[model samples]
Target: MYIAKINIMTKPEILDPQGKAVELGLKNLGISQAQEVRIGKHISLQIDAQNEQDAKEMVENACKNLLANLIMETYQYTLTKL
Candidate 1:
């Protein structure tokens, strides 16, 4: 078995209003130097794969086909043997 850890985030060029809101909220709470806050999603899944490379490929395909939006979001993942 293999475990896949995936992270999905908005593209740098895209605006993240939710992140900005959180930053502003922090500043209001007297948190100085809160430059930026970019939010993202972390997903973990177990795959019945033969090797690390195969697990990575399956996770990448999942991100491309369903998890991450190709136009606005980017994704990366790491595969660990279990």
Candidate 2:
């Protein structure tokens, strides 16, 4: 069996209001060490595949089709044998 871990995030050029809010909140809480905080999505899945190539293909397809919005977001994944 194989497992896939996907991370989806908005492009840097795009504005993230939620992230900004969190950053402001942290500053108010006296956390000055905090830098830019970008919010993103993480997804994990298990797939029945024969090899790493097949598993990677499945993950790519899923990310392209549903897991991420290609227009505004980018996605990366890691596949591991389980």
lDDT of 2 by residue, 7-31 (tens): 9999999999999999999999999
> What global local distance difference test value does model 2 have?
0.94
Cα lDDT listed for each candidate: 0.90, 0.94
CA RMSD per model (angstroms): 1.0, 0.7
Query: On residues 1-82, what C-alpha lDDT tens digit does candidate 1 reach at each position?
Result: 9988999999998989999999999999999688769999999999998887788788888999999998999998888788
Clashes (backbone N, CA, C under 3 Å), per candidate, total 0, 0
Model 2 per-residue lDDT at 62: 94
Give the number of the best model, judged by TM-score. 2
Would you estimate the TM-scores of all the predictions? 0.92, 0.95
lDDT of 2 at 27: 96
